[model samples]
Target: MADEEVWKAIDDLHAWLDANKAVDGPEALLLRVLKLSEEVGEVAQAVIGATGQNPRKGTSHTWDDVRSELCDVVITALVALRTLTPDAREVFATHLAGVTERSLDGRTP
Candidate 1:
């Protein structure tokens, strides 16, 4: 999907979450930000499971599960950013551009 569509979906998800949330204001924003940590932990768990790192589990998850968990982390992060500001799309795009430039240093390889 396009960037615009992804942002629109994130906006909609944020609105839905806000409407259903029990808390509001700063508390809600804090919780939303904390949710990103939980998603990140899930990604770690998925990676471990996929690699059979936990002897007790023995490969309970596949690579696709890790991918899904990573996607969840991204979505949760974007939603948290949207909670912080309405210009999440622009903010993310600008930060991504700067990172890309710094990492590539004008090289195509």
Candidate 2:
């Protein structure tokens, strides 16, 4: 049931992406990576801002501003791997299944 929902969510997101044309291949991957990196930077900025530490000139952000960037990184990684693997879904499934089994056995996969 847990795995069922996991794939279901991925499928749902894939469907949304299909409708939105947002998660293409390499080109999309490149863009997503860029977006993610930018977001990570923002998160860093937010940390700095929260600490009242001004990072050099024109470099500061907040928690919310950086979170989206981290999300972008995840999105881009999937897109990039998908671009290369063509069967990315299967790869992910197999890997997760292995990890899950390993976890159940209390061992590293």
Candidate 3:
């Protein structure tokens, strides 16, 4: 799906979450941000499993699993951004452009 479609879907899901009392207000905002950490941890775990980093459990996950976990982290981050502002798309786009320019020496990444 396109970026716009993903953002819209996330917005819909965010609204649904609010309606179901899953998240709200100031405290909820903090929780949403903190949720990113949890998602990141899952990504790390997936990577470790894919790489067979643990002797006890070898090759438990594939690279696809790691990719999916990373996607989850991105989704969680976007949802958290939506919690912070309704203009998350524009905000993210602008910030991404800035980071790309800065990190890539003015070349678009």
Candidate 4:
């Protein structure tokens, strides 16, 4: 999603939580981050299984299956971060710009 959309969703969730009296500030944000991490791990597991690296006996999965779970990890991460920072846009803007610049500096061509 776009940065603005991410922030809007965060704002909406914050409002919902506040309306329900379930807001707990940083503690709640941390909990969501932990949950997001778990989802990311699942994505990694899916990747491993899809590539025959799981080694869990007969464990296996398809590329399509892994892609769906990988998307889950990304969505959970953006949502969780939105809960933490009100300026997720600035954060992504600055971070991604620097990363892209540095990455381009190392390109082979």
Ranking by TM-score: 1, 3, 4, 2
lDDT (tens digit, per residue) of candidate 1 on 44-99:
99999999999998999999999999999999999999988999999999998888
> RMSD of model 3, in Å?
1.5
Q: What is the per-residue lDDT of model 3 for residues 9-93, given as tens digits with 9 covering 90 to 100?
A: 9899778767776646788878878989999998999999999998899989999999999999998888888888999999999
Top TM-score model: 1
lDDT string, candidate 4, 1-109, tens digits: 8856766776786567556645477777677778777997888888788788756644587889888998777667766666667776677678878888798995644
| Candidate that beats the other on TM-score, 1 or 4, i.e. the better one | 1
lDDT of 1 at 46: 92
- The lDDT-based order of candidates, best leading, equals 1, 3, 4, 2
Model 4 has a clash total of: 0
Per-candidate TM-scores read 0.94, 0.46, 0.90, 0.68
Model 1 pairs in collision: none
After superposition, candidate 4 runs with Cα above 4 Å error:
1-23, 53-59, 106-109
lDDT at residue 64 of model 4 (Cα atoms)? 93
Span of ten consecutive residues with least summed lDDT in model 2: 75-84
Q: What TM-score number comes out for model 3?
A: 0.90
